[model samples]
Target: MAANMFVVRQTKGTVLCCKCGILMAPNPANMCVTCLRSEVDITEGLRKHATIMHCPECDSYLQPPRTWLKAQLESKELLTYCVKRLETDLIKVRLVNAEFIWTEPHSKRIKVKLKVQKEVLNGAILEQSYVVEYVLQDHMCESCTRFQANPDQWVASVQLRQRVSHRRTFFYLEQLILKHDAAVHAIKIKQMDQGIDFFFANKSHASKFVEFLDKVAPTKRRESKQLVSHDPKNNSYNYKYTFSVEISPICREDLIVCLLELLLVWGISDRL
Candidate 1:
């Protein structure tokens, strides 16, 4: 019985499975070796679809190699599957401007007219006229820096129009502002009849600021809204929401500098 037990133990210890670090059962060959090789092959096959190359010069679109495209498709499929299983919620992110306009209409008949003269790119003359009504009251101009309370300090009839919308419009405006601020290194704010105007030390900076406004402002919506009441006796009221962004001169200067630097770097890198 002792000799039979010794032989049994020797036979069991002779064939060890290399892959799983286990003693092989009664088999003709090593069990772990074949299994380990198969596992490696499977891993390699899975990884074969993950290789891709991106352009280093410009971060724009380039023709993708076939293998890279296949890898991207496979990765996208896996990501979609995982995301569906996880039931993720999609987030909607929108950029809005911080400034807006408020207007009040008057029933008092006062004749006010505005004449805007602009020159087109083709040297064509453009002019427009609009009637404005305002209650002219004697008050000091809040934006004037004159020491004496001159009679010329009266708040003139002015129509306030916000130059930008509450969206990506301001983002570009912020960029143009930054460029001018950096170039001039100083900014000044003047309260204008329309709203508020920004002035840079350099005249070109001011021009650029105006151009930026013109480019972005045209995209704003000019639709007016009417408030309707259910009561038959009451009349519906019309209201409009105008968008504008306002910042203190000091704060605006600082922001312009920072934004310009950041955007300059981003723009350069993006086009590289």
Candidate 2:
């Protein structure tokens, strides 16, 4: 019996790039690694035609919310949001800059300049420029719609009152509310001779307002609820809540000292 065998050889090979005649190894086509990666248009996945949700009456744009409360986003923030929506998983994105171009007057369409740096294969950064178009579509938010249709469609209200009419205290309270972003929850704020009234679309917000006031100043509070609507089929009932808060009168300069002798006479001392 006889057997035959042959030697097999392996060799390293290099290919020229299809576009640019550069040497690259392990390339599927005759293209260099750099040129091959650059050929993949990341902008293809980018959304060219986009619609920005905007309210013409309020002049506010729909923004991604950080909280549960309804809020409007600024122009720059909205632009960032649009970019995120346009980006795809093909490349890693780092937004360089964005600008809105005023092409013409009375035009509903807006031209936006987006400069982004994308990281492709081998950690190579590719800079991409795109002029994205966004059509300003008129869309009304829930809060704005409620404001327009029924101005007084609030479910709860807080009546803040002080025995002495002091604008300074009320002014301080207003400043605090504005700082805490609590005022955004209120549908309306009404001024009265005794104090101010804050109307809220939800009872939770009204209760939050009362808690905020209590933390700042010691107050006596009274609550009342009235049945507003009933759904018989669903077995649900809706009630309007009213909270009356009476803040204790106190000034920065005022102080009171209690004597030990008085406590002894009243038998309120711990030793007694």
Candidate 3:
């Protein structure tokens, strides 16, 4: 026979509520859940409504002090975005749970379900559920403002011409441009009789675009530059270039490549 031993269990002592006189665990208030909820509210002073800056052109929201971020609906990114906006409002309380509440279709409004916990009555913690609403206000983003503010800021251009008298081939070019997103760097795009014109603020971008067209279709390229300004003191010359691209039915290396370039002045410097 083997020797056997018995052990005693240690448990925390329980107490009774002062108001309702019911058995409960120890707490700062020594009260029940129902009584504490009825007495104090942790959702006090929480904002019920707020306005958010939204850019309709870009589908992005402003995060104050000149920061723009993208957040899709019903996502954690949006939840964090909402919480960040409420940092000042939540100074007194702490967030326990935050989530997006579905809004009416096509309303462009957002509602967030919130749960906050706060310590009160000297160490007693209380959690409460509430909701906050966000009203979207239309605000144009900086990039959109730049294009709208200065339509004539393009510095270089590529004029694409294809000598086709009949059926649409430039239409095919449009599809190709859309597929490759090659026009993202262009400041402006205009449709012409022979073909299309792509405008850019940077001459290098024009060269890149001409390269793209050459790769996608049988084409020849030419480059030309005209003197714009001469700084005699600095011994520098500024020249504007124009690029003319001819789209051919067949590749011919003998055809001369043409380029046209123009210059426009702007305040911001292009880091690229």
Candidate 4:
């Protein structure tokens, strides 16, 4: 009677790992942790050596196939660019962490350490880390390349000039341009003795810049167009536009001073 009163309990079953023959819970690959990690390559198709296209002239990097992006040394943007380059292969697993392994700036090599995880077995996650070295390859960005090809080639130009003894007016104008992002379409911004030159590939962009200057600064605007070429068949004419912006020569703290002797000779100051 006592022997018939006992409750029956079932123990969990186990299986042997294919390679190591270690007894473990049932899993998809039928392999232990050590063997599965060694066998499975979560970082497959990821290149150990990568190339990042950089513009030596502008100190910018080529983002993917076409876009040019400016990124500071060891900045988050640079790190994001590195990670995006590995996006195709990294889709296979989840990225845990990625950080830069600092190297000399002059070395032109960026090292990124990546931690990735993959779940190959039943409820078992495998994590691994590896470093990828990115070599900066000299590739001129589109703007710089175009500029080098033809420095004078532009459809529109903005000649920004301030006729003042100091550069404070130009400095303020620069801040306004940055605030409004007025020069987004500018091909190149050049510092000139007179002031700054903003070149563009489109006439509309130059006109926009002139409008921006009108709103921000007290300036006079002049426009001129030069005929570049003509398509007789299409009856289309190509012209290059130029917008001359001259900021006022007046200063906030300036005073108009006349000497008493000079005023006496003119007999104007003493008339009041």
Task: Tell me how candidate 1 scores on lDDT.
Answer: 0.34
Ranking 1 against 3 by lDDT, winner:
3
- The lDDT of each candidate is 0.34, 0.71, 0.79, 0.84
Compared to the true structure, candidate 1 yields what TM-score?
0.17
Per-residue error at 88 for model 1, in Å?
61
Winner of 2 and 3 under lDDT: 3
Residue 160 alpha-carbon offset, candidate 2, angstroms: 2.4
TM per candidate comes to 0.17, 0.55, 0.57, 0.66
Compose the digit string of candidate 4's lDDT tens values, residues 1-272.
58779887889989999999999997777888789988887777777899889988767888866888877788888899899999987888899999999899999899999999988656567788989999999989877788889987789999998877798777777787766678877778889997998899888888878888888777888889999899999999989888898988864434234355577789877796
lDDT of 3 at 125: 95
Residue 48 in model 4: shift from native, Å? 3.0
For residues 1-272, what per-residue lDDT tens digits would candidate 1 score against the true structure?
A: 67656553443455666566676553433545445444332112111112122321111112222211111222443233322221221111111111111233232122323333433323433333333332222222222223134423222111224433333333545576555443121123445543554433333444444445545444222222234234456754433222233322233445678887897878964664
Give Cα distance to truth, residue 249, candidate 1, Å.
Answer: 24
**Number of the top-ranking candidate, with lDDT as the measure:** 4
Candidates sorted on TM-score, descending? 4, 3, 2, 1
lDDT of 3 by residue, 1-272 (tens): 33676667899898998889899998999998888988888887878899999877656789988987766677777789988899988988988888888898469799999888899776899888898999999898776678678875666789888876743557777788877867766766888887788887789989888888888887877788888789999999877677999888433222222111111134223422
Q: Write the per-residue lDDT of candidate 2 for residues 1-272, one digit (tens) a residue.
A: 23566656788887766688776674444556467556766566666677767666545566645212232333665555666556662245677877776656357677778777766655555667788887877877776688779886889999999877456667777788767866677777888888989888889889988998888877999999999889999999999899999877753322232455577678888776
Give residue 51's error in model 2 in angstroms.
3.3
- Give me candidate 4's TM-score against the actual structure: 0.66
Which clashing pairs does model 4 show?
none
